[model samples]
Target chain A: MPCPYLEYRDTSADQSFDEARAFCTVVEEFVQPMRADICNDRYALDHESHCEIYRAHAEGEE
Target chain B: MSYEAFLDGDPVIVTAALTGGVHGKEANPNVPETPEEIGRAAGEVEAAGASVVHLHARRPNGERSFDTERFQEIDDAVRRHTDDVVIQHSTGGTGAPDADRHRPLRTDPPPEMASLDMGPLNRYDHLTSENTRGLVDSLHAEMVDRGIKPELEVFNDGHRNEVHGLLARRDLADPVYATLIFGPGTLTRPRPEHFLTAIADLPDGATFNTLGFGRHQLPFATMGILFGGHVRVGLEDNVYYERGELAESNAQLVERVVRVAEELGRPVATTDEAREILGL
Candidate 1:
């Protein structure tokens, strides 16, 4: 199934995950190096885990 | 374990609400009070297809207590039976001091997860459910800092929004989970439209389970399966299996949920599966 959040943001109605992953790529713009730097210690990519930070903000707008 | 996986028709995670903040033998003689009894009940439910155990500690006299020592003992006993069953200690028991409320979060050896209410509410006689934003914020930070997953208890739409706020502030871990509770005087009624609407707009990666106070327990479990969500069931939610019928043990309630889910073709999540599913 399509990623629900991606469908929500793009209004694609596909309910797919690829759309969500693709959306995450756009999000990596700001969160990429910053989140990687943040997640380095004691947390295997903590900031980027699930890309939740970007998703929460993006989905909240919808 | 992620919502993408779960929403892809994954097995349903069954959480056994072994002992809640309220109720005792008077409600059901089989309700486990002491650590030994709780340990036995935990084993039975795990064997009966339960992957997680949500627990509350009681004083030697059977009254609820948030003492770290009591929770530690109960956690130890439950672990002795099987490490597979995820132990989710609760921090939201009623009538406890602020110190006691924070005990589980600050305890030496924390649990896999802990019950954290979104905010406060008004309930039965002389009871006021209060979870201030300040405390809620602090608790969220502690859970993230200690590696303890927060099993957010959602009492209404406000609670739902509160979770989003926490996420925006990055106070919670990824794949966050919520337990939407429906009971007498709850903000939302126990109806399909109400439940569906409440979680329909959930943010991506946010998953929630469902439960009811008494008569609504079985219905809540049934609805959860039908809606592609997880389920919570046990004596803590209801002592009776049906009208005028008292359940013999928590295993009885859990067995009923398993049988129903099977008849509907939804496989049960194993102990390890639950840990992974919940991001433990």
Candidate 2:
């Protein structure tokens, strides 16, 4: 599943991935697809999550 | 990627090439010539949304210098003013001894990145930047030793082919980053189709940065964002804010590009994101 905080607007003429730039709410920063690709969208998985901020946020909730 | 499975594109990484060696205050008085000036400009550009600062050291008299000490001083000044912007040094030059080209990478804490010209290109009627295969290999080897990522400078299609040649001979770090430059002289022609062709020609998994000289800067930068690649701006590539007026500051140029990216629905990459994208 895509990260919950990953917000994007796809407006490409053909609706391709060309125009989709993602932003992460947890860190309040724009992120590359590489980071967004593996994020769990819910609770962060300790070894699998590429985002430190999302992991910390999930830990705080727990 | 085809939308059978769609994937988000990378955020735009805005790089500010603060001051170029070819021109100085004479071209634009706002071009920073001293360590303090460059540092202050670095901070401003970072605030305006650039995640990387491309640096060129200058002598006290405003001439370009490849001295390691000068690079060190500039790096020190940059750190004093900004928090996390990546620092990239320019190693491409004309008429300099082949050995002196290595000076920029020898600073105490060498730049996190350095430009590596893929091949030779003509500068003026009488001069040529002889970035022969041997020099290119030597520079790439040093960057590898220092853990500095080489931002391959692709001036034309020949240089693009050289990128393939370099990759065939030696292994570069993952996600090979190259800057596709457009302009007169030895640079690729400034046209949308040419830029698209360059993008199409890039080896798989390599990320490209868009740079257009002078009047081509803004339009190409917008296209870069639309195409989901990074961008570079500032007085180094352009001295004007518009056709006739000189740019007030490097920050102004960065600010304009940031605005364009936002309007196009693309978020600007933060410094951390830039590091992640570039593997720096």
Candidate 3:
């Protein structure tokens, strides 16, 4: 998702419009699918964290 | 144990927001402010078939608060008065900024659930409210640590996409509980197509609720029941009971929701059933 915070903050004139355009162009060129594939890894981490919390609560109840 | 079973039972989970943070005593003489008054109002709504009470604590002088002591008093008072109704606190207390909106959860830990506003919203059409990425991550961490469920509040399609992002990133859990807020001059206008479009974006195993601001509350709530989503109603989001008359109490709003649900042949879900449905 586009970061509204960044959008609100980057309106400064110090960074020229040409510079910002060039930065975006460079980022798009360098982007790779490997970073996008990390979504599954993040999902696994979240699942483990949830299970740990549930296990702790179960133990406390016991 | 599944939400599908609860839906099959035809019971809607009615959440009564007893003390809304926006309105004050001047708008309606019955807007509960003190902890004792809020607890008392919640008790009545529970008796009137509301399974959950969404609370917003106020200072003694009627200002909103995320103070631990104030929230504790309300939580304790509500527990004293009712056993069946689930107590859910709002993280978006008055005067709270994006950085500190989840202070209630941090200080008081968590109740049964806490509100998780999904994304940046142009609330009231006057403010460009931003819930920063860092704030969302921290709030999700707190909820995870405390084992408290989050009631995701989505105000627009962009908000829905934020929820999807959280789910995709695994920041949100299964059977996410969402509430679609509809109002005029907002992202989604108060209408059936808006509701359908919002529902269409929901992921699998997700359950949703609906609330409409102002005069649209009744019609939107009726549509919510027919479409198998829960309903929220109270004077905080609205003042008048009808075209001109003011609402007498929060219980009156709760009663209206119940009547609409019953008229649609949907029974009200109990607190336990609601927990299962929302995966709390």
Candidate 4:
């Protein structure tokens, strides 16, 4: 699952999520999308664990 | 080629720096940290129009490593992933032993090009890179012996002045290429007039590549294109695609420069053309 804060903007021509540039609500900034393989790892806990910004924000919330 | 060629429309060579020694993933997660990641980034940038990939090796822990075996690993991976992009290694570092700096040039097939910082410069608040003349001369000698082209890195005007002394003392291959870096700290100020003056002060017949740290990257790259010089860009220099927008990949940075150059009537040089222009 993608980071709850992650939202896509300017989708790539193929409209692939991996290629789309994204906006992070936590940081209020845009960022390059995470790679498909990294985002789709089934064993990973959550997308926030993969993103430093989201992790930091989630930690702050805790 | 000279600025006169700007009217004649010469091809611009774009170099993508895959990773740098200073910063890493914490700065931007997309900044490749491992050999495999760098190789993939190299392939992506090459396809996006960079003919040369400037590389910096990192330890498994993600700290900078100038070790030969590490560079060899990165080089091998780059070659496996990219078809014909030129490989150029970074020999500049902060506070490393001078002898250790030479290790990057000792890779089995020796890179086609390596950076040779012309003089010393300050990095962060307390660190200084003492690129003494002895180190510079020794590195150049090794590069010459290994048949590697030197990319003289001029961080400030004093370093740029040293370029003249170097040319006088050493027998550099033709079309002397230098990278004029501009930004804060010890680098020349990122200003238009300063860049023009820097280019004007270059040794006659010398080629220049523009490098501007962070937000200055685009404007300086545009200036480089308009002035008939080459450009260096990638996450190594600036991690942002725009203000507040982190760059997606090295290829994303190269693609923008390629587009800018194309719209300005400067065709991007292919790998073969870049080699020919640099006399590689």
Candidate 5:
């Protein structure tokens, strides 16, 4: 998917960090600073992790 | 954290509503009213842990005032004591029939931030506080025009919707700052579920602080920090610091919030950080 912050048209789907870097290299030439500032902090991330675990448990039961 | 960056992280901003308009000298002898007393009380609270001081002005006779002179006096006095603490003035005057509640904003030099009630709410089981939509729009416009950030006061789910609508209409800015007021016999009951549900409905880029009425202050305040929000505490919301014991000063309440934040492992936001977070 296209990056929400960037206005690129030939963007591909979301992928792992290495895959994303390779795709960016193929599509264009840019080296943007990777800042995790936009990412949620440890608390919110931990909450999300718990939610994923609960979802997996529910899926397994089904 | 960068100012804007920290808000996205939901840093807790504790505001001490030092002297609310509800109680007079008869209710709590230590409640500050005069300029000197109010300023001194605010200074102590800021020192304790509060980044912001919510102010309500009164004459020597202990009557609330929306008049500019009274507000200026209190503002000047607070400035005299401390320049780092944020000063927020209340728009809710005495629960009077004909009193102009918005008179403080009408003052020549308005407050840096003003309280804007989103909707009407019942107070304590006797008084009906009026907060019409037209009043909200007008007040919001004035505050935006005057470069004053409004502390949106939400008492229920409907009030939350109103705030959302205001933002959708571009009447308010991003990172919408609000105060979720919880009290008995009001629109919102003071409970964990009430807080959780209210917060769940908050829009993206929005931040809120919580305050409970009467004795429920500490519980809801504690929850506010744990739930990734801010806290507001003072005699204005509750006169008693503990069960059956009247609070001696606003500083005592501020000190309590400080302790609670420390216990919860949440760092208190400074005035400058709060201004940047709230876009004040």
Candidate 6:
């Protein structure tokens, strides 16, 4: 089963469910506006590894 | 207890690619999903002569996942069935979050081996299976730090090149294990001709395994046996047992390998034997 949000979101942004947890708070922040929507609940900033999050940003920017 | 079983001079290690990240019960109703199902499947495969289980943890809903808690559950479940059999967790999957892939390293009892995909892969066709240098470096560092072996996954020549460079690096220890996947796409077709040549190209003290997709799975596995290498098999590579027929269980695949090994006069390595061969 894919993340519930995967069907509507960018598939490229789609990763494993744990990845959503591993990434830092940025993606969560990006999806913050949609928190009220139960369909987007998987986008919370839980167990955000500052290292993976910041590095992903740095790599993405590069 | 001793690993002398592999030293009979004709040892052949069989690794079971249990439940892959892509497939579900729809593809094969027997595909293990829950911890209980995976554990039962591990027991069956072990009895059928599989020394290693290549795991791709899945959510309760059958979605591919890498949650640490879930992995721990899977690990414990597998151990409950058998202890000597090595548990190798996968870190590569299409859409796998870069960090989530490494969650295996963070498990309470880290896996004996975790997959480290080398270079890039063109998945299906459109998506490029990317493994950036930073990610590779970070994964290697984590593996070394955690005392877990890297089951290097090489798909193409560029992946071979990456392995070549990695062998020279100080971070990785000697006696690395490489699983060369063939028949993924036309780009990485399982070429039996290059199997030996690829192994020759690896640095000193490297063991290898082969995964042939679809129709090529069993043939390539035989090639590995004849070539003095290891083999990985399960519905993950080819869901069918024959033309248009779905396999009943991973154990069926392992049983076939055992029969093939017998015919070839090569002894299937026991779990203890496999550990020795892997230096675990």
Best candidate, TM-score: 4
Model 5 clashing residue pairs (backbone)? A1-A12, A1-A13
Compared with the true structure, what per-residue lDDT tens digits does model 2 show for residues B51-94?
99999987764556788999999999999999989999999766
Ranking by TM-score: 4, 2, 6, 1, 3, 5
After superposition, candidate 2 runs with Cα above 4 Å error = A1-62, B1-9
Second chain TM-score for model 4? 0.99
> What range of 10 consecutive residues in model 6 chain B has the weakest lDDT sum?
B1-10
lDDT tens string, model 4, B1-280? Answer: 5668677789999999988877666568788878999999999999999999999988664556778999999999999999999999999876577888999999989999999999988743434678999999999999999999999999999987799999989899988999999988889999999999999999989999999999999999999999989999999999999999999999999999999999998999999999999999
* lDDT, candidates in the order shown: 0.72, 0.82, 0.69, 0.84, 0.70, 0.72
lDDT of 3 by residue, A1-62 (tens): 22111111111333322111111121222111111111112211221122232234446769
Model 1 CA deviation exceeding 4 Å by range: A1-62, B1-8
| Stretches > 4 Å off in candidate 6 | A1-62, B1-8
Against the true structure, what is each candidate's TM-score? Answer: 0.77, 0.80, 0.76, 0.82, 0.76, 0.79
lDDT string for model 3 (B1-280, tens) is 1234335656798988887665556456687777888888888898888988888876554545667678888888887788768878887632255544665675454687888777676533223446665777778788888887888888777888888888877567777888999986545777788788888788876788888887888888887787778888887677778988989998998988898788767888888888887777
Error of 1 at B238 (Å): 0.5
How would you encode candidate 5's per-residue C-alpha lDDT over B67-165 as one tens digit per residue?
778888888899888868887888863243223666677655667789988887764322356687777777778778877789989987789998887
Model 1 chain B: weakest 10-residue lDDT segment is B1-10
Clashing residue pairs in candidate 3 (N, C-alpha, C atoms within 3 angstroms): none
Tens-digit lDDT string for candidate 4 (A1-62)? 65667555534333322223445556555543222212232232245444455556778989
- For all predictions, the C-alpha RMSD in Å is 20.1, 22.5, 16.8, 9.4, 24.0, 9.3
Q: Which stretches of candidate 4 lie over 4 Å from their true place?
A: A1-62
Query: Per-residue lDDT of B1-280 in model 6, one digit per residue for the tens?
Result: 0112223446889999888776656456677878888988999999999999988877665666678888899989998987578998888754456877678678877888889988776543224557876677788889888888898998876788888787766456657788877885633566766775676777667788878887788988887777777889997777888878889999999899888877877889998888888888
